[model samples]
Target: MLCENCGKNEAAIHLTQIQNNEMTTRHLCEVCAEGMGLSSGSSASAPLADFIAQMGKGMLAETVSQPGTCPACGLSLADFKKTGRLGCPRCWSVFDASLRGLLRKLHGGTQHSGKVYLPPHPSESDRTARIVSLRRSLTRAVESEDFERAAGLRDQIRRLEAGQEA
Candidate 1:
């Protein structure tokens, strides 16, 4: 998948974060990941396993920065590891850094490599893609001082938004 952050390079880093029963996921290319303070010594050609290991180390550092307690339920990392269960839903995040390794070992990988759902049209996401494309083109046009082209793109964006609202 493409990096959602820059929409340029292929995503080299993928993260899935769960907190308060909500899951947030994002994919990032190396460039963007480094910018976000997720710097790694791995190169683009580094093995996936290596990247994951590095990411796990990073996560471990973050969680252990303050304390071992879950902010919500006060479940300590040691306790969670001992019990092999979480005290509450919030424990997932509280122990996220520590669990990446266990999950990698248990599942053989942190990411799923399987079939996925794909809509026949994917209209909404498709529209969003179009808007992003148009916006990029609009930026280029404006940068090049092509007033006519920029105006056309601006109009197209407005029409797309109108359709979306309706």
Candidate 2:
């Protein structure tokens, strides 16, 4: 297939954009795709993972200046964009907004739809880990002033505690 934009080279990129119940498809060569901003820089020819990370960077660039730092590691949003890695466990909450946007852009959806691997019989350790994780999330929610999320986490924690007692 020929490039839809330039009509010169063979199409190497197929992009499907859906907006408001309308779908638009474009087939473009590397050159045209890069020219149209559908691709990244000179490294646009890189693998899909790199391309997706580039897209995430572009999406996060605008929000990097937001004031928030990981309470545990002191990682700022700008630092995450540069390294593409969180400095500490608490960084997730600190950079939640930017990370969600980046995740949605990179994965096309933020929700996890993949199969979860669980042991046939969950051990006591698993329950303990779950409770610990929930407590951390609850703490982060409260610190971030997300009362609604904190409430939900509280309810979940209560349920888990009740289950343990029972």
Candidate 3:
């Protein structure tokens, strides 16, 4: 498409503005748009951005002013923010508003109500630690020549490692 401004260059951007009950559309190439001072249109409203940032900060501060207690687990929102995790399901309900705001900011104004996937069994870190501890016990049994204890420890370690792969 030819640029509305130049007519010679291909249109690479579309700028839309509404004023006085009339909508105006500007089709322009990047160079023409930049020359017309329309490339950084939003940055022209820096004061508005600053005002919004201040308002958001104030809202977050107000939300955190009073200690929030989860109705289900009695966990505090302030504590959860500090720890980066909620104590229980009730904490989610108690801090629903604040969490919604946070989620919107993080995910582009959309609430996250999606499915969560969990590991089938213990995580690799847990499996590795358990296996290490079991191996130590197995070594002790071997040193004492207790075949039965060694066999049991070996079986436990196998189960833990197998769970990790699942």
Candidate 4:
């Protein structure tokens, strides 16, 4: 088929999207696919369908079943597809040839270039700790009938809640 987007080259890439029980498909050549960020080295992250398209476009049909099953859990490609899961951790290594190649194509290269995840920031926790300490002091002031200190602590907590540095 001729490329749908550019109508210039032969289509080598095909994409399909299903939304709200409706299906839409696009056929594109290498140039158009890359322009749509559906190709390797694209800065924009492709969605799950793009990942599947990268896998199933032509490779799935041409791939010969690698000989033998996973040594650790005995999972074949067919079993993995049918079950939609790997048999065990070792399945990754056992299926390394196929999996790694697919990953390389879907991502730009073998190394992960995307952002590494980080936990909540330390300053946020520190703010929470400060708030807790102030609340405790406020409670102690109230217990001792120290209205002036209690009011000051209450105002500090209100400022903290308002996102002001107290």
Best-fitting candidate, scored by lDDT: 4
The digit string of per-residue lDDT tens for model 1 on 91-120 reads 776666567666766577778897898776
The model with the greatest TM-score is: 4
Candidate 4 lDDT: 0.77
Q: How would you encode candidate 4's per-residue C-alpha lDDT over 68-97 as one tens digit per residue?
A: 688878887766544435679988877766
User: How many pairs collide in each candidate, listed in order?
Assistant: 0, 0, 0, 0
lDDT (10s digit) by residue, model 2, range 30-61: 88887877764444434654554466568655
1-166 per-residue lDDT for model 3 (tens digits): 9989889889887988999999999889877988987764443445544544443453456474445587677777655554445677766667777766665765667555777998756666677877898899999999999999899888888877777432
Deviation in Å, model 3, residue 150 alpha carbon: 54
In model 3, where do residues sit more than 4 Å from their true spots? 1-59, 62-67, 112-166
What is the TM-score of candidate 4? 0.49
Q: What is the C-alpha RMSD of each candidate to the true structure, in Å?
A: 19.5, 21.2, 18.2, 14.3
Task: After the best TM-score superposition of candidate 3, give how far the Cα of residue 156 lies from its true spot, in angstroms.
Answer: 51
Worst 10 residues of 1 by lDDT: 43-52
Lowest summed-lDDT stretch of 10 residues in model 2?
Answer: 40-49
What is the Cα root-mean-square deviation between model 3 and the actual structure?
18.2
